[model samples]
Target chain A: MRWNYLIAGATAAIVGSTSGHATTYMTPAQARVAMFPSAASFIDRNVVLTPQQRSVVQKIAGIPVRAPKIMAWEAVDAAGKRLGWVIVDRVLGKHEFVTFALALDAGGAIKGIEVLDYRETYGDQIRNLKWRAQFTGKRHGATLQLDKDIKNISGATLSCRHVTDGVKRLLATYDAVLSDHG
Target chain B: MVLSDCLPPMMPSFQIMGELERRCRPLLGTFVEITAPHEKAIAAGFATIVKVQSLLSAHDPVSELSAVNRLGHRRSVTVDPWTAEVLQRALFWAEASCGAFDPTLGGLMAARGLLARNDSLLPLDPQANWRDVHVTNREVWLDRPLRLDLGGIAKGFAVDCAIDAMRAVGVQCGLVNAGGDIKGFGPEAWPVTIAMPGSREPLAMVELQNAALATSAGHDASGGLDMRHLAGASPAIASVTVEAASAMDTDALTKILVSATLKSVVCLGLAGASALTIFVDGRVIPFELKEPTA
Candidate 1:
């Protein structure tokens, strides 16, 4: 249940951010505590899937397993009673990377999900001064502010389809691997 | 030793600066991001958005909006004050635009497979329009069986509510963006970029100060524009971006401009909003209302 390493890793990740678009919403430890406030302990139950297990997961999830390793934690109460499980996973958005934590209750139903990090890979192109200069003082007659980062965008809404699909895959992971665990 | 060597090494500071905090979560079928100076403010903002979604989401059968849709034709369904307020605004825009921005198109959207159809609900009346909806106090009643989808304006209302939540927490400046609908308020201007429909290409950049901005695009599958929410919209227009004092107005105005009837200009003037429309042929038009003479 010690969370020193988790705090350290989170600090390192935040300090390493050079791009403005990458946002870290919560540390792994923070997310665990938020998802399971009553848990007395969190046991690291990270899994490494066998080839057969991977295929099973892919079949159940209807999505290809991108990796064999999965980061997971098992929550236990003060009386050593099993509470739930938390699975950390990553999925690619259309032009971004989303890292999220999906929590499942003891009955294998989804408790909640939280986004840990969101990084827009396309952010750099818009930040380019040359690319932005083309629209400067254009026919739109709106004042173009060039020096600031494109922190907010107003355009067609982007669906959270990737994250939803990622949740489905993680749920299948639960049904395939963690469902039978003690 | 050089002058720089005599001084300390000019390395970038690695310490965390406690000035700004940003968070993003999936809500209202899209990612809602909030940026504020304090963590509590951001949390409050997201909490408010969650409440609004629970009350107004048509996708959730247990929500008040779904309840109204399921039984409004038969009985007066009571809704939360916030839901009633948004419904009132929707009616206002619907009236101003002369059916160009109808909220009763939910039946058409369901028929088109844009929204899930509930078999248990009463049969929809194709003749139902915004005029069929009646709102008095917190009660909403439909003159006929018409599914009401607030998808066109609810996100903006959520954004506005989130901003108010942030302000309640003593947040001086903050921004709330639900998908592409955004509102920012503070002393300094928030810089935002406008992307082309279905692409990340930068179309324009504008500074929003204590204002709201929203963009609506035509049916472009690749662009991720859910044109199903719009009624009688012209597909020839690529996109329309509106700016107003409130996010709800901006959000509804974008849809009004996309439909583009003669009354839309009057709606823009009455709402104190302006719009920028990008045509499919790459023509950009700005609609600025003339000042009324005293």
Candidate 2:
């Protein structure tokens, strides 16, 4: 479409309203979600999941999609080691917009995941269905560096990182909430 | 010969050539017609053409064109085949520029006040695209709204054209030296010095034959590096050299080679010319004219 482009390059600062929500989580997003829940809901009311994992979380919460942004629960076992779970929500930075559910288990491991929505623009990053299968049998709380541990598709660096960023936020939140609760 | 006829009565034998030696203004924005005796001498004289081509330098932001129906929509005003030749050779420089040497930057040039004869300048419509211009052998069409200025490559092309015009005017042995874009015709033994600083003391002098040679470099009178064109292309090179079927090819090739590096050099070689590239590291990559494989 050869539409007219009348827009000039703008230099104004857009003061984000969500700055108040970002707080003391290890990740910027955790800071965001903790400091400003009311504003956080404006953007990240979503997460990423896989098929087998989707049904796992959905069966637990009964159609996980409609669950109001959970102020999810967390805690470690008697050993006091790194272990707990939180169902935090995040979105991908990929041009491909795929949103879904992600769940961590009691040992702070990946319990399951299920994609609620998916569409792609280019090479499959999470869509080739590797995210769930790779996490299977893997312990929870593993650092989610997709390039090192997960076989993220090539030419899909940002897309792959988007999913991992989501996972990192979820884990950090679990760490935060579980430490406080325990 | 008395100097009073055209000069002060105190000077010795002289007319046109002597006056020219005393003052050689940068030959830009002026049309030149050479009137010299002897063919090989005229062909060898193109070393002077090299000097004039350097003055067209100004900052024009755009990916310098490599070839085409036209460099960009702004260039649709004329065929500028000579410009097309230089743009094609300047690929090396384009590689250095990372896209700054673009001929497609007609809009940017207009904004920068670098477009010569820009009195009728009008801001391009927002919808203007480089691809809008259509060109053919007979005419070039600038559809809708597009303004192109070939200020970058025009001097080199004029240099080359002047060389050809020199030959047609019965110059049996001479050179067209448009500052640095030089072409030699007739005889194979005139001495030429490629006086680029730091290359060597003798400056890589060559025996001029039926060949074209261009070296990309110059210094202002104060010895300050005049890098206006070379920097425009952003090549990883301080200089570039090109030898082709014609002087025009060699002249513009230096600019293209400054930034466009691999893409443009390969393009020149593909189009049947002998080309070589000198990197900033002093590494030289040479190309031989050959029929290209798909």
Candidate 3:
């Protein structure tokens, strides 16, 4: 019995070192780099929309900008070349919150998208690789509606719609805020 | 380009106090959201969470928990005040649940490859019950060589600590959600939803007024593993969501209700928590919370 226990412990120790716990896939900093591989540094920028900008953002995105101001990061490469923009945003899923990174290029097109953290116990089908891939290279000015533009997951309606709406808001914010800055 | 003339400076009747000031950071292997009335409160809340994570994380090699797991059997190891508080609560639940919520299963979990080992000797016999672990004041002593995994309840305790930090900074109206183990406070009740497995709709929508809610479901609830299996939880349970005055209680109770045997149900009922337990066959049981009478 002791020998069996020893063997089991040794096998588990080997497996544990290589695998990570389910919840943590990537940290914010790691997600920033993964989203913009060409970028060498990320310049942290915070934006408090003016009344006019907020109104336009809400009108364009068709969603309320929860806070008066928001935060984003500018990914810059060596010699000060701009790579893209990284925006960390949250959306209410079926339950709890779904947080992701909206990586938009200089031309206001989505470069990549990654789920940073998911809080809901179910309906995480939004994190499916195929679903996320459809958003890549989509431009901000386009009508990026949930079912109208991005395909919805079968049993993850709220997560799909809310995440799509969040992306739309990110794009509108990009056009209103970072388009000129970049 | 400055459209300041055409727009109002700010919306009228928009109370400044009602404005949500929020921040997020990666801690305790998940995203920690701290929403408060001021940046000071948010900063303090995040700091408190990080402090608790470092002290109690079983995976961290330098954590006090790791040290205790390594040498507590040799001598009574002095732990942080917060660690002691959490451990005391854990022990209570462990006994209350009749070993269903055992913390001493850390080594068993490690041996089963659920959690990483932290340089502690694995129990050969593997039945290192919670009763064997002892705590007094700020010291913890283990009767035998067994690791203690606080992964089940540490996050909730950290959330409560964050709430405390917010109150310390005079921020009353806010919510702290550490990977969906949420505690909400203030005059207004916070709306919470528990998602139904394999469906888009929610199983329940509850309001938390200065309260906490925690959900423990099958790993496959989100197309994942059976996480409760690691804790020796009953295979019949599909999910359990508990709401209580404290996140610590709710967190620990979810595990207990899902895993405890039928005989332990009476004691669990006397503990005074409202819960919804969904069995694997779609049967739902709701226990309305009763306030403890003085």
Q: Which regions of candidate 2 deviate over 4 angstroms?
A: A1-182, B1-26, B29-102, B106-119, B125-130, B143-146, B197-202, B218-226, B230-232, B275-294
What docking grade does candidate 2 earn? Answer: incorrect
Task: Score every model by TM-score.
Answer: 0.81, 0.41, 0.61
Model 1 misplacement above 4 A: A1-30, A33-42, A51-66, A75-84, A93-96, A104-111, A119-148, A179-182, B1-18, B218-226, B292-294
Better of 1 and 3 by lDDT: 1
lDDT of each residue in B5-30, candidate 3, tens digit only: 22222211224334876555556665
Scored by lDDT, model 1 comes in at: 0.76
Residue pairs that clash (backbone atoms under 3 angstroms), model 1? B198-B223
State the lDDT of candidate 2 residue by residue for B181-253, as single tens digits.
Answer: 5555654333343432221111123344567666665333232234443436553554555666565556556
User: How do the residues A1-182 of candidate 1 rate in per-residue lDDT, one tens digit apiece?
Assistant: 00000112222222233443556788878788878899999999898888998899899889988878989999999999999999999998766788989888988888878889887655333322332333333322222222234457777887777898899888888888888762
Better of 2 and 3 by TM-score: 3
Q: Model 3: residues >4 Å from true position, as ranges?
A: A1-182, B1-18, B119-125, B198-201, B220-225, B228-230, B263-271, B289-294
lDDT of 3 by residue, A1-182 (tens): 00000112122232223221113335678778767777989999767889988988899999998776676899999878888888888777444466778888877898766567655433334322232233233211112111111110111112144677788998998888778862
Q: Ranking by DockQ, best first?
A: 1, 3, 2
> lDDT (CA) for every model shown?
0.76, 0.39, 0.65
Q: Best candidate per TM-score, number?
A: 1
Clashes of 1: 1
Residue-level lDDT for A26 in candidate 2? 24
